[model samples]
Target: MDHAETITLADGARIATWTRAGPAEAPHVVLLHGGPGLWDYLEPLAGLIGDEATTHRYDQRGCGASSPSDEQSVARSVADLDELRAHWELDRFVPIGHSFGATLALAYAAAYPERVPAVGYVSGVGIGDWRTPFRNERRRRAEPFAARLAELSVPQRTADEEVKWRTLTWATDYADLTIGLRAASAMAHSPHVINQHANRAVSFTDADQIGWAAAVRCPVYVVHGTADPRPAANALQLADRLARPRKRVVTEAGHLPWIEQPEQLRELLAEIVQAGRC
Candidate 1:
């Protein structure tokens, strides 16, 4: 991927966006990263599908290199996505969202179904409440690494400390801790870069209330790792609610399937692109 370009939104917030040049007429895909406040970590997955589509990935407003704002909300994030699409001059595109990004993507599609040809929800936070299940799953998986994780999570942390904290916590998101650590290492290092206000605001909002799946007019492809903490049952339920949906459950993967099952993910992405073209 090339260096990011700055796009100033209507509200004057500048978002950092990166695009991988591909065939002019290829399908366009915009990747939404998770963590209402987390930086972009989807570059590896973008690289895997670069030849198939004109890929675009960005640090959403108030995250990574994007300008921070106190007005951050799910509504604002969805608007930012629309702004991005307009900036790219794309009449329609496919959105591939991971974790919380999936929630945002669904919201975007709900608000403007005509702009989205299809969606790829990878390890998505599906409909209904996921907090209780996620907490329980995290505790169950973090038991083995509790001591080390506890030591890493302090009140105030330096950049390296934040990286260690994120790495330790995210390590459980994979079937293998080693792979998880390696994957998490690519995450943004500075805690200062994350907007806690935005994270808290979006977290408290209910994505299901938006009625995005029901409003969706295009095919939705949902992928979940069987071992992911959010639960595969949620994905199944979400697929059932959509107008048209397809799903794949990767047995050995966890939250970040792109890290654990890149080849399989690439194939799934290719399928989504083809489906969109159809």
Candidate 2:
């Protein structure tokens, strides 16, 4: 947390951002947390690789301390990232994206390949139809918490209910069920609201995915956890589409590999960031 500030975009959307300093000569890396609606939750990840590269993270628009707005679109999100890059005076940087952020990072790289040296894709929902399988797997895994989770899914919920709901909903995302509830609860932080609009705006069709994959010229490192409800096969397909791609599947880890396998994820990210300097 070396630096934290609010960056006001030209379109009047203010994004809350944080920067952690690393070695002065190290390349810059931007960590894009999952969830179009959820606030930033990559601080631990930033700290893990702080010795190797300067790390940047932000709460997407309408999330956390960022100004709330419904004007969400993939183009707007890319523009905001570019503005942040200009503000930081970075010529180029590696983008490490998780879940939905992985897709967003790809979109950004496709739009401005020159500004992006590489991309780190973690737990991304890849091209084609992946949601059906993910939902089926999650449903089976979440059976124990199903009743309570359903009760908490109403449009309006108390803060405690929000936390509980999120915890139950995300409990299936971990390889170890014993620690899953606790981890998910801890992640259900402030601004409990989920920007459904933002989530809808950033989705990629099969065509969009293939086009972006073909458009991006930089190297892409795709990593997925074996135990993650989201199938790693999708990530494999995405990696295959890239011109320069590196793929890894971590055994026994969950959707958020940094939490389950920090050392491995750190090493991989360090490699990607170092490549950005080339």
lDDT of 1 at 267: 89
- Candidate 1 on 1-278: residue-level lDDT in tens? 56578999998999999998778778889999988888788888789886888888998888888887778788889999999999999999889899888887778888998888899888887756677898888877788778977887788987777787787787778887778777766663544466677778885333463367889979888989988988888777778888888888777899998788888888898998887676
What Cα-based lDDT does every candidate model obtain? 0.82, 0.85
**Candidate 1 ranges beyond 4 A from true positions:** 1-3, 188-192, 204-210
Extract clashing residue pairs from model 1: none
What TM-score fits each model?
A: 0.93, 0.96
* Shift of residue 100 alpha carbon in model 2, Å: 0.9
Error of 1 at 88 (Å): 0.7
Angstrom error of the Cα, residue 44, model 2: value is: 1.3
Q: Tens digits of per-residue lDDT for model 2 on 1-278?
A: 56998898887888889998888898998888778877788888887886788999999888777889887777777888899999989999898889988988998999999989889888998876688999999999888878888899899988888888888888789998777878887887555577777777665587887889999999898889999999998888878899998888777899988888888887887788877888
Off by over 4 Å in 2: none
Q: TM-score for model 2?
A: 0.96
